[model samples]
Target: MNRSHELQLLSLEMQNELFRILDFWSKKAIDSEFGGFVGRINAAGEVVPKASKGAVLNTRLLWTFSATYRKTSNELYRTMADRAYDYLLDYFWDKEDGGLFWECDYQGKPINTRKQAYGQGFGVYAFSEYFLATGNKESLAYARELFALLEEKYRDPEFEGYIEALSADWQLMEDMRLSPKDANSPKSMNTHLHILEPYTNLYRAWPNEKLKERILVLIKLFQKRIIDPKTGHFNLFFDRNWTVQSEIVSYGHDIEGAWLLHEAALETDETEVIQSVRQSALKLVEVTSNEGTDTDGSVWYEKEGDQIDKDRHWWVQAEAMVGLMDAWEITNDDWYFQGLQKAWEYIRANLLDTQNGEWFWSVDDQGNPNAKEDKVGFWKCPYHNSRALIELISRINKLKI
Candidate 1:
């Protein structure tokens, strides 16, 4: 088949998969007893009623519903977005603290009230999309509020990058762990990549000079510090003084940040910034394409201290699609396009759970799905894969028109 025909077929399948996940999760995973979505759905697709809710998972659900509604113009999707929005206001929002909490109890009462910069950024992301879809002035104001808090508490005037985490009252914290898998470094590429992402979406809605300037600085920081020019992989952890603490490379963050960095730079419309960012991003795709991607076209997780996990993570595959597409756009390379298509094929064949609904957390190196990770949890959600589909549809349509 021709390229166009093949992409069209893949796009249709992606849409079906996206909708299937939305339907299944909306029907089963939502906490009717509680206000928001449930916190944990175990590997067997069982919702753990007592599991604590996470701000990241709730905010991502909000983004998914809002984006899905905007893309499909479906009232049901808007209702889902509204459900998540209400729960966010009621549970996640820290009225006295000025940002969202890190974790909440099963009944929507926040227990671990640490104000993570990552969670606050995603709050801005979800609220901005909610405002865009519904034109609710309150949602816009909430997004702006979160954005301001991030600036006030997280942005380092001397250091130039956002701080990793804070107390409930916005004081700096020492144990800044996003999860058990992550290193307890003072600075992380994951936090900064997310900061750039929400900043891009926030700028789309509320483009004030301050926001623009900070985003420009953020784009430059990745180009300078996060990205290793010699290797093209993102350095995982750093100290507060902007010194690299580890040489560990995450293939997922490299590819995800590649396109996301370009998105941030392109949003600013600074020719110099765009040129530099495009070079780094395209080179990122090239280097990781050589090292991380498998013959089956799926990207692998990182190696740590001589151990290669080789798990085909769901988010890595999703971001690989956008990264390859971004490379294709930058260089007009047929190989990048082929990479995107093949990666999607790999996801559909392996990562996607045709039996249960949403995707598995990962597949082993040999292409067998690992059944231990939760199907939906603090980490797993529809955001990564579904957003990939939405981004691909928009990018391809832009190319065609």
Candidate 2:
């Protein structure tokens, strides 16, 4: 097929996959007895009704449905987004505290009331998208409120980047870990990356001068602190003074950041920053494509020194496809295009669960699905894969193939 034909085919495929994802989540993940969506659904397709609901899952659901509604004008998607938005404000929003609580019970009561910066970022992201979808002034107001809250509560004046976690009342917490698997450090690449992502989205919706200034600060944080100049890989964890705390390389974050950084720069509309980040984005993509990808085009989970995690996670592969296609757009490189194709092939063969709906959590090195992980959970949501499909469809259509 010609290059134009190839892109057209890819766009159609991505659109189909995007709708399939929306259909799966809308039908399977909704909560009937309890408001909003269920917290956990096992690999056996059973909902764990009593599972503690996470801010991330709910916020992502809000963003996905809102964005889908915006794209398709589907009233069902709008209804779902409205349900998520109401649940978020009614249950997750700490009205007195001003930021979202980390987790809530199935009955929509706060369980873990810690204010995670990552969760706050997603809150802004979802709310802004909801506003764009429905032109709801309240949603936009809440989004702007969250943005201000993050700036006031999470931003460390002594340090450049935001803190990881705080108490429900916005007090500093000793254990600032996002999860048990993460390092208990004051700073993390994950939190800062998410913050940058939402800020960019918020800027698209609001375009305030202060938001623009903060977005530039986040871009600089990536340039100076998070990304290693010597190696393109990101330093996973950090101390308060911007000290690198861990030698771990999270492949998912790297590829995700590769494009996110570029998008942030693009949002700024500054020629100099855009030109600089364009180069940095390609380098990050190059490193990930070289060291992180398996032979079958699946991205490895992470690497600490020589100890490489061979698990091919669903999110990692999802991000890899977008990031690689992003690189292809920047450089018009056929290699990156091939990488994108390979990633799609691997995802269709391995990551996607044919019998069950939606993508699996991950597959082992040998391409065996990890059945132990929850299919829908706090960390596992429709955001990455769904966004990837939407992103690929949009990006491919823009390519002058």
Candidate 1 Cα errors over 4 Å, as ranges: none
Candidate 1: the clashing residue pairs are none
Backbone clash pairs in model 2 (N, Cα, C under 3 Å; residues 3+ apart or in different chains), count? 0
What lDDT tens digits, residue by residue, belong to model 2 across residues 1-401? Answer: 88899889888988988888888888999898888999999987788869989999999999999988998899999999999999999999988868899999999999899999999999999999999999999999999999999999889899888999999988899999999999999999999999999999999899999999999999989988889999899998989999998988988889999999999999999999999998888888889988988878889999988999999988999999989988988888799999999999899888778677899999898878999999899999999999999899877777677
Each prediction's TM-score versus the true structure: 0.97, 0.98
Evaluated at residue 80, the lDDT of candidate 1 is: 94
Q: How many steric overlaps are in each model, in order?
A: 0, 0
- The TM-score obtained by model 1 is 0.97
The C-alpha stretches of model 2 lying farther than 4 A from their native spots are: none
- The model with the greatest lDDT is 2
Candidate closest to the true structure, highest TM-score: 2
